[model samples]
Target: MGFDTATTTLLRAILDEVCESISRHETGVRAHVASKILEAATKGEKTPDGLKQIGRAALSEAPTMWR
Candidate 1:
């Protein structure tokens, strides 16, 4: 009920192609844009193992004001 299989499959394939173009990243600091592909494949709101680390730093972790 979370990962869109169709999207994940397509994205995963794209990541494969991209990695081929850059085996030894010279000075790049970015991960594969399709990292979501892996996340969706592994995690699904229920699991957190394969979740992409992208944007995670910006995600709000503070508790809500719903006391």
Candidate 2:
């Protein structure tokens, strides 16, 4: 399912914030975070705060090459 422009914008903003919070520069890491955020968004997580929480939790759980 496709998201509206506002939802897309919000998701992008949330993704950016997550990446920044995690200091994720590697493409793989960024993509993983983005996917997590998108998954949350698709699951009806529209609020930025909620999305951020989900994204952060996912990031914390995700296995990383560098810790």
Candidate 3:
């Protein structure tokens, strides 16, 4: 499903905030976080706080090359 401009912006902002501590080169981690956030959003979670929570949890559980 396609999101509206505002929702897309909100999701992007949440992704950036969640991945702030990670390197920009870490696409796997970023993708993981994005997927989680998108999943939540598609499931009717449009709230920033809720999406942030899900994004953070995804970040923590993200796969790392070193792991």
Q: Residue 66 of model 1: what lDDT?
A: 15
Give one digit per residue, the lDDT tens place, for model 3 in 1-67: 9999999999999999988898888888899899999999999999999999999999888766722
Which model is ahead, 1 or 3, in terms of TM-score?
3
Candidate 1: tens digits of C-alpha lDDT, residues 1-67: 3447765565545454444434444213124334444555445422332233332321222122311
Write down the RMSD of all candidates, one decimal each: 12.2, 1.9, 1.4
The best candidate in terms of TM-score: 3
Q: How many backbone clashes can be found in candidate 1?
A: 0
Which residue pairs does candidate 2 place in steric collision?
A: none
Best by lDDT: 3
> Could you give candidate 2's per-residue lDDT for residues 1-67 as a string of tens digits?
8999998998888878877856655767777778888887888878889999988876787676833
Candidate 1 TM-score over all chains jointly:
0.32
RMSD score of candidate 3 (Å): 1.4
Clashes of each: 0, 0, 0
Clashing pairs in 1: none
Task: Evaluate model 3: give its lDDT.
Answer: 0.92
Off by over 4 Å in 3: none
lDDT ranking of the models? 3, 2, 1
